[model samples]
Target: MVTYRAYIKKDYKAEIRWEPDHPFLAGLARISFMTVLLVIPWLLLGMKAPELTPTSSPVSKSVITSQQDRIIEPSAIDNGLVIDTAYLPENEIFETTGLEPPELEEIIDPINDQVTEAAWQSVVVSKGDNLARIFSRLNLSARDLDAIMALGEDTLVLKHLQPEQVIQFQIDDNQFKSLKYPASLVTTLHVVKTDDGFRAETLTEELEIRIKHVNVIIDDSLFLSGVEAGLSDNLIMQLVAIYGWDIDFALDIRSGDHFSMIYEERYKNGNKVSEGPVLAAEFVNQNIPYRAVRYTYEDGQSDYYSETGRSMRKAFLRTPVNFTRISSGFSLKRKHPILNKVRAHRGVDYAALSGTPVKATGDGIVTYLGRNGGLGKAVILKHGGQYSTVYAHLSNYKQGLRSGNRVKQGQIIGYVGMTGLASGPHLHYEFRVNGVHRNPLKVELPQATGIPEEEMKHFTTQIEPLLAELDNITAKSGLITVNSHSDLRSSVL
Candidate 1:
């Protein structure tokens, strides 16, 4: 209630009483008041300071370290005031003392435990390596090998380890947790340890069969031309077999001859594993074109046929045996090499190495299978009705073959030898129609069985596209003069 000017000049004090007889008491009272006055302002200042400052939540040792390491000094902006970082409180100073964080063991200990828990080892099969030897080398027990082999025939594929084949084993505590063997490009054998002994499973990888086409012109040899066209030797051999009956590859092939084919390539994991079968093929020999398309019947029997559905096989193969060259051809009157006189050389002589396999040209019964006068070791085959073939100058006959024994075409009947009138290792082959001799190379052989009438529609439908594809490639590339797709199909139909 005092006036404002009077209140500004007012002196506030607390009253105290002291005895006049004791001067020391008065001195003590004066000193006590001064001490209280000095300590009051400092105590108020300490309490007010906590309220003004921004309070932070308690942080762990790891969190403090992460925050300090992440912080960067503030940079001046266009010569303006730069904000500097404040010092940490005394309690948090120990957090930045260069000690390892407690959470690192919390994170890395689990990682180390995982690394030791699951581990794998791989071993490649070396030369002369068997399952027993391989397991022994790896310090695995014999019982483990026996258990793996006892899984049955499917597991037996793992028993035969070819050199360079790899076997991978998942190990835990020096024992096999699982085993994996890649048996082939598309197959893997897995043996896993289970509570109930060991279990084996075969994992068959899916394969992609891609159809590919190639066109090749004969300049030198078929083999060389095939290689140039990126075709494998197996594919080339298959191509030859498809057209072998219609074209005598050794004698009938001429300059400007060409071939085109569509075949299958098996792929696994985006890489080509091997070649499959020839799907369709065409060959032009001496201006005549031969076309073949492979077809599989409902019963799984497969064979090559013309677009018109005629079988590519014939009653006899053109050549009885694969030979180097034609040493002698069929002739009515010719001088014998050993006889030194003009005599009828009724057969062709195929020059080859001694012991080269001689195959039966046609399915027939053995009429004679013994040594002959001038032909040396000979075998005479009598076919149905009008056909008869004679093979001579043989190294030896196939065992268990005798007169009256039935033999199939392409069966090995004997071997090449320099027997009888031959001057070198060669095969003497003769073909007769009824009692009359004929040129084996020029004879018109009977066609094999064709597609049944009921299946012709499907076969024609399937082959048209292949034939069209082949002709398209040939025409575009100017590879050869081949029959038009329609013309070839009509001939077969």
Candidate 2:
């Protein structure tokens, strides 16, 4: 420590002085003063000599033996509480007599932690929501997001968030633990966090596919009869498609014609989810029975086939478009509605709603795509060297369909519209062979490839039971259609 002094004189003059100590001498003096002060406290307390050696008191051997043989009991303390100090080991008593023990740092294993159960939180995906946004909403870090996405490409499915899809999260202490994301109607992706890292797996459910049989009598129309017989519109369309190769649905369907269907229906968790393909069906038109069965080959290719294993698919679909009615038939000298003059009508006009899809009847390459004089927005397909098909009066052509692009059979090529000299929205379809116009409704189409000889035995075995069931249903002419829920089940079983 340094000291400053000031001296005042009577003549208004003042003198100031400052002194500093030498570092080595000041350090020795400070230590000596602290040592004397410490010893003075001890001397004033009358402390004589410090005990250097610890003292021990000897106990008799008989006393130690008696203490071990006695049964100690809890004794009442001053606070009226029972104390059980007698059960504590002697070493514990020695430890408690000294200073308090030091606190130990705990080691926590995440996987084996006592607080393992996580509270589940469910969030429905909303529009414009993504996985990162959801993670941020849950106060999760970007590092966690990266770790989860590291699961692989399949884990990226979390990025495709659909509105209203439920995504579940298991969170503990505001940390992400696991996730349950429904990948599809029958599959879910389960992502879990482990001690090492995040793990992901796809869990799928097996749906039960059962056969269903339905018999219906045509009273007014196929649609009405199918609806009355408890058949979905899709199933009815499939039924018409199976036999469309042999029958003309627009003109040949009779009121007395009847049909039977054996199709596949899928169920999940004891509840029907949706309908599958038509396994077998029979439609009698004009007293002619047309039977078709769906068969799958060993190579995993499948199609509808006849009872003799012949393919039901022809070279062309019967109707180019599903239409309301035949507005005009193929004619030779029909009066034009727009021109008001007798003109040679070479094609059939199918009346349909505007923007209805028009399909290519056969697999062929587009030969022409331009606006004709009367047939506007037209497409002409050349099948082989001799056969050609024309579709006219379209709203727009199918994207990517050009002069050289090849289209398959029943592929949408254009839409119906009232373009160029036309009356309303309708499809003007024409078929030509050897550069000669032919009636589309009457022309015979080629047959597609049938089942191979090696697969014929398997095909026969599968169709036998389906045919027997059809025959049994047909034998009961007056048997009512099973429309009730339980009756329908019985019919299939």
Candidate 3:
């Protein structure tokens, strides 16, 4: 049995040695045997392996002969045709053709529809016209106007329509859609049309009031001095506003009448648009001093005051002469231009053209308007609490002006003329406090109310920052010069 086993082992080893020496031939034989084995089951089950086509089947062309240099040509069967190529593998034939596959189309509903909306237009109000008239001119229905008017009386007044005030209208095919009124320094309203009819809306804008301090030092002309001191002409006019009741700027400002003011300036977006009231001011005329301080009360009313808490505003101002030159001044001994005599000059003389209107210096009842000895065409006003002002030498009186008629501060009473106590066409102004003659330019007038106690905290908070800004500006401009003296040290400390 051992010898027979050894002979069988030797025969098997000899059979292995007799196999083909070419690896290609050996691999071919093995492939043929595996193909036969794979085909038998397929054939027995009544199934046939698909023929490979270059444009179709990719699996059949993937299997290759053992020789790398040999290429397989595809079969000509229409079901699965394949082609041989020197450039690329048969599986990549479809990709090399550079043809994109057909894409599936997206489905959309054909019955859907869409509608577009329209836009609105805007308009601004012009001068001397109200909103109701504007709406009427636009051909809006009376019902709509009535509806708008019914919103509120305040709303109607808000719509009183100042120049450049903007208003918007919304319409759809000539039918009213809505209306929009933007808030400004005035009230604003908005209305919209809905299924239930028109609905109104109110939008309020919170006003941001910012204060700035502006100072002006008169050096040359008032206009030039204001420009040099960074004071806007508007602010300068405002500084002279309060004094309009007292002094006529066109006639009263002297050459050396320097003025200092702390006034309220308003700004929007860091740009100054308008100015507020003058807060505090000091005006010096011919070496005489006058000061005014503005104060706000608990009830939100404001007035000018003196340092001593009296009204800076008196029952009367010092003079009524307006837009005139001081051709002559008060003097104890002087040659009058017309009289040529040394006479007691009791009043200051202002020279102006004839028919130049003279104003009453304060609120008072007109006591006299006829004439006096040597004084032609005079008007006298008796002010409150034993004070009176007289305007003499007039061409005529203002219309409807007569004795016993009440006059407010700065009311026009008469005109300039060469009347009694003769000179050229000039105005002689006199001030009598408690029936005693006092120097109109030098007398200490009664004071106005001071800053109210309730508004003190608000004023301080608002004014501190403005004062700091003013200090910075003054320092930068070198307007305030500091002297190394004991007084300076005391002031600084």
**After aligning candidate 3 to the native by TM-score, how far in Å is the CA of 259 from where it should be?**
8.9
Clash statistics: count for each candidate: 0, 0, 14
Q: Quote each prediction's TM-score.
A: 0.70, 0.64, 0.56
Tell me the tens digit of each residue's lDDT in model 2 across 17-70.
111143643564576468667854443222111111111111121122222222
Best by lDDT: 1
What lDDT tens digits, residue by residue, belong to model 3 across residues 352-386? 68888788877789999898877788998898878
Report residue 452 deviation for candidate 1 (angstroms).
3.4
Give model 3's clash tally: 14
Candidate with the larger lDDT of 1 and 2 = 1
Q: Positional deviation of 433 in candidate 3, in angstroms?
A: 5.1
What TM-score, to 2 decimals, does candidate 1 have? 0.70
Residue 42's lDDT in candidate 2: 42
Local accuracy by lDDT, each model: 0.70, 0.69, 0.56
